[model samples]
Target: MKTVSIRNPGMSWDIAANILVPPGFDEGKRYPAVISNHPIGSCKEQTAGNVYGAALATAGFVVIVPDASFQGGSGGEPRWLEDPEQRVRDYRDVVDYAQSLPFVDPERIGMLGICGGGGYSIKATIIDKRIKALVSITGVNFGRLMREGFSNFDPLGALEGMAAQRTAENGGAKEDINIFVPGSVEEAKAAGIKDIDVLGATDYYRNRCPAEGAGTRMLVSHAAPAVAWDAFAFAETLLTQPLMVVFGDKPGGFGAYRDGMEIYGRAASKDKELVVIEGWSHYDLYDNAVPTGIALDRLVPFFKRHLSDMPAGSATNPAEANH
Candidate 1:
C-alpha cells in the first residue's frame, strides 16, 4: 500500500490518494483497477473505504482510495465545507490520474461510491465517461438530507432560506446558529429509534463509547442554507455502464438501497443490477462486521464480465504453440 497525491492544475490543489497492490503486483501482470470514493466528512483512512480497497487488492486488483476533497488527508481550508459540483470534478480528476498509471487497465476501471460517496458517484457518471462500472452502497443524497438536518428526512427546503440568509449577510447581520453533533435525544427519535438517555448532557454527548477526537465545528451549520442547490440526479441519466446497487435492510439503511434500486430501474443499459443485504446497516457495509464477506465479491465479476478480453492472449498456451 502506498499513499500519493495527484495535483490538479485548476484547483491549484493536491488530491491525496492511497494505492494498494497485493503480492506480485510488479510481476509483469497488469491488474484491473477500482477507484473507491469515501464518505463525506470522512477520509481515505475511514473503515468503510479502507476495507473496500483492501478487499479488492486481495482479489488481485489495484485499488486507489482517496480522501475526498476537503475531507481528511486531502487538502481544503476551513475543513468540511461541502461542495457538490467540485466533488464530481475531484472524482474525474482522480479517475484520470488512475488511468495514467503504468500498471492500470484503462478500460477496466470501476467506481465504488458509498453513502455520501454514492451520490457523488452517481453525479460523476453524468460527467465522467471513463468509469465502466459503478457500485453504490447504502447511498445518501447529502444535498437533500443535509438541507433540513442530519437525522430528519425532511424536504422542507434550504434554498430560499439560504438565499434570504445570504441577503442578510450582505445587509450586515450577525447571529450564531448551529446544529449540534449527533446523538441528541431528539435526533435519536428523529432517526426513528428509541433514545438512550445520556445524563448531564449540556453539549454534544453520545450514549455509546466515549466520543473522542470529534468536535463540533459549528460553522458547518450554514451547510444547509449555503448548499441549497440541486444535487446530481442518477435516475435522470440512466448510466449505460455496468451498475450495481447494494444496501442493508436495516433502519436508516432501507432508503439507501431503495433509492439505488429506483435509479437502477431507469438505467439505460441492460447491464445494471441491484442487490439488497437482508440484515446489514449503512455502517455494516462500511466494515463494522455483520459477516466476513466483502461488498466487493459482487464487484469482481461485475468488472471481469464487462471489461472485455485482455490486450493479447492469455488462454493460448505459449509453450505449446510450437507443437
Candidate 2:
C-alpha cells in the first residue's frame, strides 16, 4: 500500500488516500478496483485502510481508501466540517482518480463503505453509475438519524442550536466544534449515556484503536447540511447497481440496523443481498475478528462475482483464490 493525494476537481481540494494494490501487482495488467470509505470523523488509516483496505488488496483488488475532504489529511478550509454533499462527491472524485491509473479497470470498479461512509457510498452510487457494485456495512443514514432523535435526544433542537451557532460564526464569533462521542466510557457512564452505539464508539475511538488525524469531533454548523441530506433518497429508482447491505442484529441508537433493512427493501438492484449477523452490534463490524471475517467472506465473493471479467464463480486471480 502507498499513500497518494487525489485532487477533487470539482471542489479544488486534495484528498489524502492510501492505494493498496493486490499482491504481486502487475502494472501491465488492468485489475478490478474498490474504493473503501471511512466512517465519519475517521480517516483512511482506521477501519477503511488498516482493516478492509488491507483485506481487499489481499483478496485481489486495487483498493483506494480516502479520507473525507475537510477532515484528516485532506485539504479544505473550515476543518472538521462534515458536509454530507461534499462527502458524497468525494467518492466521485476518487473514482475519477482511480480511472486515471493505468493498472485499474474503470469498468469493474466497486465500492465498500463502513458506518456513515456506507450512507455516503449509497448516495454516491445512485448518481454515479461508474460504481458498478456496492457493499454497505453497518450503514447509517445520517439524515434519517438526525430527523429522528437518537436515545430521545432532540435533533430538531440541535438543528436550531446549530443554526444560531452558524449565525454567530458568521458574525466573527469563534467556531463551535462538538465532540462526536464521549471522551471515555467512564465519562459516558457518569453522564448516564446508555446508548450502546455511543458507548461502543467512545471505546473504539478512544481506547481500542486511536489513529492520528482521527477523532470524535465535528463542527457544530455541520447540522445545517447533514440534517437535510438523505443518503438513501431515490435509492428505489436510481440504485440499480449490485448491492450488499450487511448489518448486525443488535439495534443501536444510531439506526444503522434500521437503515440497512430499509435500504435492502427499497433498493432497485435485482442483484442484492442482505447479510444479518446475529448478536453483533454496529461497532463490532468495524474491526472485530469474527464479525469482520463474516462480512469479508460475503464481500470478497460478491465483488469477485460482480467486478471480475471471468465467470461469476470462477477465480479471476490466482493470488485472490489463496486468500
Candidate 3:
C-alpha cells in the first residue's frame, strides 16, 4: 500500500489517494484496477472505501482510494463545500491517473462507490465508458437526501430551508450547517433519530471512524445544487455497464436497500445483481467486521468475473475439456 498525490487541473486541488497493489505485482504484467470512492465529507481513509481497496488488492486487483477534491488531504478552498458535478469529474480524473500506471490494464478498470460516492460513481460511469463494472455499497442520492430529508420526511420543508440558506448566502452570510452529528448516542436518540442512517452515522462519525479533516457538515450554499442534482437521472436509459448493488437488510438499513433495488430495476444493464447483507445497520456495512467481510467475499467474485478473461489454459466446462 502506498499513498500518492495527483494533480487535478481545473478543480484547483490535488487529489491525495492511497493505492494498493496486488502481492507480487510486476511492472511487466498489467492488472485489472478498481477505483474506490468515499462518501461526501469523508476522505480516502474512511472505513468502507479504503477497506474495500485493501481487500480487493488482496484479491488480485490494483485499487486506489482518493480523498475527493476540496476535502481531507486534497487541495481546494471553501474546505467543506460539496460540489456534485465536480465530484463526478473527480472520478474521471482519478481514472485518468489510474490508467497512467505501468501495471494497470486500461481496458479492465472498474469502480466501487460507497455511500454518496456511489451517486458520483453512477454519473461518472454514465459519462465515461472506461469504467467497465460498477458497484454501489450503501449508496445514497445526496441530491434527493438534501432536498428531501432522509426517509423523505418533509421534503418541501427541506427545500424551503435551502432557499432561505441560499438567500442568506447571497447576502454574504457564511454559515456551515452540520447535520447528522450529535455529541452523544443519547443526544441522537433524544433528537428523534430513529432511522438507522442518522443513528448509525452518528455512531460511526463520532466514535468509530474519526479523521482530523472529517466532519458531519456541508456549506449551507451546497444545498441548492444538491437539491437539483440526481444520481439516477439516466439510469433507465444510459447505465449499461455490469452493475452490482449491495445493501444491508437489517432495521436501520431498509431505506438504502430499497433505493439500491430501485436502481437495479431502473438500470438498463441485464447483468445487474442486488445483494442484501442481513443483520446489520447501514453503518455496519462501513467497518463492522462480520458483515463487511461477507460483502468483500461477494465483491471479489463479481469483480473477477467481469474484470478478467477466462484463464488461458483453464477448461470452459469440464465435459468439453475432457472430450
Candidate 4:
C-alpha cells in the first residue's frame, strides 16, 4: 500500500489515504474498488488498511483506506473534532477520489466502515448513490451513543460542560479534551470497572495495536454536534443500496450490536443481510484474528457479488482465489 493525498474541496484540505491494489494490478483494466474507513480515534493503518484493506485487495479488488479529516494524517484544524457531518462528507470525498482513478470502476465502488465509520458510511450511502454496496462491522451510531451515554453518563450534563469548555476556549483557555479510553485493564480491574467495551478498547488501543497519530482523544466540544447527529436519519427511504451489517453477539457500552440490528431492520435495501458472529465482543472484531477471519469470509464475497462483474479469467469465488 502506498500513501496518497486527496483534496477535500468542501473542507479545502487534503485527506491522507493509503491505496492498496491487487497483485498484478494493471491500469489498463478497470477494477472494482472499496473504500475502507477506520473507527473514530484511529488511523488508516490500524484495522481499516492493515487488516480489511489488505485482505480486500488480495481478494481481487482495489481498496483505499483514508484517515478522516481532522485526525490521523488528514488535514484539518482543532484536531480530534468528531463532527459527524464532516465524517460523512469524508466518505463522499473519498468516493470522489476513487471515481477519479483511471483503474477504478466508478459504478462498482463499495464501502467498508468499521465502528464509527460504519455509522458515517450508512449516512453517506443514504445520499451518495455512487456507493453500490456497504459492509458495516460493529457499527456504532455516535449520536445515539452520546445522547444515551454509557456507564450512566449524563448527556445533558456533558453538553453543559462542553458549552462551558467552548466558552473558555474562546476566552483563550487551553482546549479541553476527553480521553477515549481512560485506563488500562489492570487499572479498570482494580477500580472494579466491568464494561466489556471499555476493557476491550483499552487493551486494543493501548496494548494490541497502538499507532502514531491514533491516540484515544477527542475535543470535548465535539459532543455538541455528535449528540445531535444520527447516522441513520432516513434509512427507510434513502438507503437502497446492497447492505451487509456484521456484529458480534456480545453486548457492550458502545452499542454497536444494537446499531447493527437497528440498521439491518431499518434499511430499505432488499439485498441486505445481518451477520452475527457468536461469542465475540464488539472490540473482538477489530483485530482479533479468529473473528476478523470470519468477517472477511463474508465480506470478500459480499463485495465481489455486489460491486461489479469480475474480470474474464479471475476466480469466481474469493476463497478459491490465491492471494
Candidate 5:
C-alpha cells in the first residue's frame, strides 16, 4: 500500500491518495478497482473510506482513496464549503483518473461511499458508467433526511430557515453560520431533540472517524441548503449500473436501508442487492465495537463478488498464472 498524489485539472491541484496494489501489480495485468468516497468534509484517511478500501485491496481489487474536492488535501476555493454538485463532480473525476491507470481495467471500476458521500456516490453513478457496481455505507440521503427526518413522513421544519438562508445567499439577509452540521440550538430547541450543542454534535461526529478522531475534516457554515436536493426521482433509467447497498440495522441506519431498498428495488438494472446489518447502528458501520478489519470484511466480499470479471484462482498476474 503506497500513498500517492495526483494533480487535478486546470490548476495543478493535488488530490492525495492511498493506493493498495497487489504484490505483483507492476507485472502489468489490468485489474478491477474501487474508488472509495470518504465522509463529507473529511479526508481519505477517515475511518469509513480508507479502511473499507484496504479491506477491498486485500480482497484482490486495486483500491484508490482520493481526498474529496474541497476539504483536506484536495483543492477547492472558499475552503470547507460543502457543495453537493462539486462533490458529485469529484466522484466522477476520480473515476476518470482510475480508468486511466495502466493496471486498471477501464470498464471494471466501482465505487463505495461512506455517510454523506454515499449520497454523492449514488449521484455520481447517474453520470459515470465506468462505475460497474456501487456500495453505500450508513447511506445518507441528505435531501431525504433533512426534509423527512428519520421517518419519511416527518420533514425537518426547514422551510423558513432555508428560505432565510436563500435570502442571505442572495444578500436578502445575513448568513446564519450555525446550521452547518445540523442540530443547532435553535433547530434543536425547535425540534426539541436532546444534546443539541456543538460539543454534543461533535462527539457523535468524532466517533465516526476511522483513525481515532485523527482523520476527519469539516467546517461550520450554511454552505448549502442541501435539504432541497434529492438524488432520488432524478430519473429511473439513468442509473443502469449494478448496485449493492448496505447499512446498519438500528434506528439511525433505518432510513438509509429504507432508501437503499427502495432505490435498488426500483433501479432499472437487474443487478442490485441491499444488505441490512442486524442490530447495528449507523455509526457501527463507521467503526465502533468491531475493528476496522471486521467492519470492512462485511463490505469487501460484496465488491469482490460484483466488481471483478476475472476468475478467482486464475493466474491473475502475467506469467505466474499462465504457467
Candidate 6:
C-alpha cells in the first residue's frame, strides 16, 4: 500500500489517495483496478474505504481509495462543503488518473462505493462509461433523504427548513453547523437517539475508525445543492454497467436499504444483482467484520466476472500483501 496524489484535470484540484497493489503486482502487465469510495464526510483512511481497498488488493486487483475534493488531504476551498455534482466528478477524476497508469487495464476498471459515496457512484456511472462494473453498499440518495425525511416524517417541513437555510446563507451569514458525533456511550444514549446509525456510528468513529477527518459536522448551506441533486434520477436508462447493490435486509433505524433496492430495480443493466445481508443493521455493514466480510465475499466474484479478459498470469508479484 502506498499513498499517492493525482491532479483532477477537469476540476484542477489535487486528490490524495491510498493505492493498494496486488501481492504479486507486475508493472509491465495490465491488471483490473477498483476505485473504493468512502462515505460522505469521510476520508480515505475511514472504515469502509480502507477495508474495501485492502480486501480487493488481496483479491488480486489494484485498489485506490481517494479523499474527495475539499475534504481531508484533497485540495478545495470552503472546506466540508457537500456538492453532489462535484462529488460525482471526483469519481470520474479518479478514473481518469487510474486509466493513465501503465499497470491498470483501463477497460476492466470497477468501482465500490459505501454509504453516501455509493449514491455519488450511481450518478457518476450513469454518465461515465469508463467504469465497467460497480458495487454500492448501504447507498443513500441524499436528495430524497433531504426532501422526504429519512423516515418520511414531513416533507414540507424539511423543504421549508432548507429554504430558510439558503436564505440565511444568501444574507452573508455563514451556515457552519456541526452535526454532533456522539463521543461516548452515555452521550449517545442521553441524546435520546433511537436511530441505530447514530449509535453504531458513535462507536465506530469514537473507537475503531482511524480517520481524523471523519466527523458529522457539515456546511448547512450545502442543502442548496443537495436538495436539487438526485443520485438515481438519470440512472434508470443511462446506467448500463454491471452493478451489484448490497445492503442489510432489515432497516434497523436507517432507510437506505430501500433506496438501494430501488436503484437495483431502476438500473438498465442486464448484469445486476442485489444482495441482502439479513439481520444486519445499515451501519453494521460500514465496519463490522462479519457483515463487511459477507459484502466482500459477494463483491469479489462480481468484479471478477464483470472485469474480464485479463492477460494470463497477472498476479505474480510475490511481495507480501499489506492491509
Candidates in order: C-alpha RMSD to true structure: 6.9, 4.8, 6.2, 5.2, 6.1, 5.1
lDDT of 4: 0.88
Q: State in Å the error of residue 85, model 1.
A: 1.2
- On TM-score, the stronger of 1 and 2 is 2
Q: After superposition, how far is residue 5 of candidate 3 from its true place, in Å?
A: 1.8
Off by over 4 Å in 3: 150-172, 251-254, 310-323
Summarize candidate 5's per-residue lDDT along 96-180 as a digit string, tens digits. Answer: 6776676777667889887778888888887777677887776676667656642234444455554556666577454444333
Error of 6 at 180 (Å): 5.2
Question: Any runs in candidate 6 off by more than 4 Å, and if so which?
Answer: 10-12, 150-175, 310-323
C-alpha local distance difference test of each model: 0.62, 0.88, 0.79, 0.88, 0.64, 0.80
| Shift in Å, residue 154, candidate 3 | 5.3
TM-score of each: 0.76, 0.93, 0.89, 0.94, 0.75, 0.89
Error of 4 at 254 (Å): 0.5
Clash pairs, candidate 4, are: none
Candidate 2 scores a C-alpha RMSD against the true structure in Å of 4.8
Which residue pairs of candidate 1 clash? none
* Residue-level error in angstroms, candidate 3, position 120: 1.6
Candidate 1 vs 6: which has more lDDT: 6
- lDDT per residue, candidate 1, 205-263, as tens digits? 34322222222233333455325544345555546777887776664522565466666
What value does the lDDT take at residue 235 in candidate 6? 78
What does candidate 2's lDDT look like per residue over 102-187, in tens digits? 77776789999998999999999999998999999999997777667531367678778898988999999998887888888999
TM-score of 3: 0.89
Worst 10 residues of 5 by lDDT: 212-221
Mark the regions of model 4 whose C-alpha exceeds 4 Å error after superposition.
150-153, 310-323
